[model samples]
Structures are given as C-alpha cells and as structure tokens.
Target: MSKHPKPNALIWLILSVVVIALDQWSKAWVLRDLPEYTAIPVIEGFWNWYRTYNTGAAFSFLSDAGGWQIWFFTGLAVGISGLLTFWLSRAARGDWRQALPYSLVVGGALGNVIDRLMHGHVIDFIQWHWRDHYWPAFNLADSAIVAGAVGIALFGLFDGKRSKKA
Candidate 1:
C-alpha cells in the first residue's frame, strides 16, 4: 500500500497560537473593562459577566494551599502542553480529527499558564446561573479546553468504531 504523506504538525501549532491569542485577548479585555467579583447581567437569568480569579485547578481545588498551587498549576499546564505538542508532531497530517483537539488543548493550557505567570491567577469573566445558583466563572481558555475535550471524546468514539469495522 502507498504510504500516506506525513502530517504537517505546524498547522496544529498555528491553530494553538490562534487559540492562545484569542484567550489572552479576551482576558485582557475583561481585566481592563470589568471589576473583580462584580456580576453584570448579560442575559435575563442565564449568563453574566462576573470577573473573578482562580488560583488553583477547576473549582479552585487548591486555591487555599497557600500560594504553592500557582507554580504547581503553571508547571502542570506547561508540561501537558509540551506533551501534546509532541503528540501532534507525531500524528498523521491529514487527520484533522486528531490535530484540532490536541492543538486546542495545548493552546488552552498555555493560555492559563501565562495567566499564572503574569497575574498569579486565571482571570474568569463568564458565568452561567439560574435563579440563585451559579456556575463557576470561566474564560476563553476554559471554553477552548472544554470544547477540545468534547471534540476528542467524540472523535475517539467514532474512530474506535470505524477501526473495529475495518
């Protein structure tokens, strides 16, 4: 069988860069135009702009660990991003099913790492709520990460089934 052309991982890196740029830009905008802990209603009862900071992992897991969580999370994200980059480089170039999700994950990880370096925390500005209950605030990086994860899961399921049939 003829060999498939090598995947060009650079395209995925470019996508990662775009994600990082958008993530940082949105965070900057929130920082400049919004106040901390204050919620501004964007919808009747579903969404709001609530500027906040997360110094730890999701749901502030280690936020109260006395500042060590900052470096820990930063290091963790950097390490993960590096590994994902390496994985992307080895992935088949024509398989966007693999590249896009990996790139997004790398971008989102790096975006939050930058926040840890620059501000000691991740800036979150988007909130979803109903009545008196509210979800944790999140930012673009978080959104990208979630989207990428979902993509990866969906792709994995479909690809696995396809391979079984082959």
Candidate 2:
C-alpha cells in the first residue's frame, strides 16, 4: 500500500477555510452596520443580533483582567490551532470522524484569532434568551468550535464501542 494518506484527508482543509471566511465576513457585516450592544430581535424573546466584544476566552473568562487577556487568548488560540493542524496532518485521510472535527476546531480558532488581532476583541452578535435568562453572545466561530467539540466527544464514545468489538 502507498504510504501517503488519501486526498480526502486534505479535503477537510477546504471546509475549514470556508468556516473562516464565513466567520470573518459575518463579523465584518456586523461591525459595519450594527451599533454596539444594541439588540435587534430576530425572534421575539428568543434570538437577537446583539453586537458586542469579548476580550477574553469563552463566556468572557478573564474579560476584566485589565487588557492582558488579549495577548493571552491570542497566543492560546495560535498554539491550539497549530497543534490541531499537526494532528490533522497525521490523522488517517479516510477517517472523517477524526479529520473533520480537528479541521473545524482549527478553523474556529484562527477565525477568532483574526478578530482579536484586528479589533482587540472577538466580535459577538448572536444572542439566545428566554425571558430574563440569557446565554452569552457568540458568533459563527464559537458555534463551529462547540459543534466540533461535541462531535469529537461523540466519536470517542462510538469508537470505544467499536474497538471493544474487535
């Protein structure tokens, strides 16, 4: 058998690029038109486009840390994306379960990194809520990251079962 992985292994990179493009484009639209912190409801009491910024990690962790979190999160995203890229390169080409999740994560990380570098914060606009309860604002990059993480977890569960049957 040939030593090289199948071309499909690299196909996931295209999806990653698309995610990055969509994320940046959507953020650009929001930045240009939306007034910061103003909510425009798409679904009454449920969803809204609320432009905001996060200077720290998920859920604004360390957001109030006196501005140092920018570089910290930037560096963290860079490091994580690099590691995921390396992992992707080494993963089996035919294994979509592995390759796709890693690609999603890498795309999401780089997407947010672009925002951090250019705006000094991650632009967030999508908001979901119920009555007084609200989830933190997030964007396309955050969605992809969460989905990818969940996919990886589900893969682990199924893969473990398959391995035991072998």
Candidate 2: Cα lDDT at 59: 93
Q: Which 10 consecutive residues of model 2 have the lowest summed lDDT? A: 4-13
Q: Quick one: RMSD of model 2?
A: 1.8
Q: Over the full model, what C-alpha lDDT does candidate 1 score relative to the true structure? A: 0.89
lDDT of 1 by residue, 1-166 (tens): 9997675675778988999999999998998999889889999799999999999888878988999999999888889888888888788777789889988988998999999999999998999999999888888888888888899999999999999999
> What are the Cα lDDT values of the candidates?
0.89, 0.90
What TM-score fits each model? 0.93, 0.93
Clashes of 2: 0
Error of 2 at 63 (Å): 0.4
- Tens digits of per-residue lDDT, candidate 2, 14-38, equal 8789999999999999989999999
Candidate 2 overall lDDT versus native = 0.90
Steric clash pairs (candidate 2): none
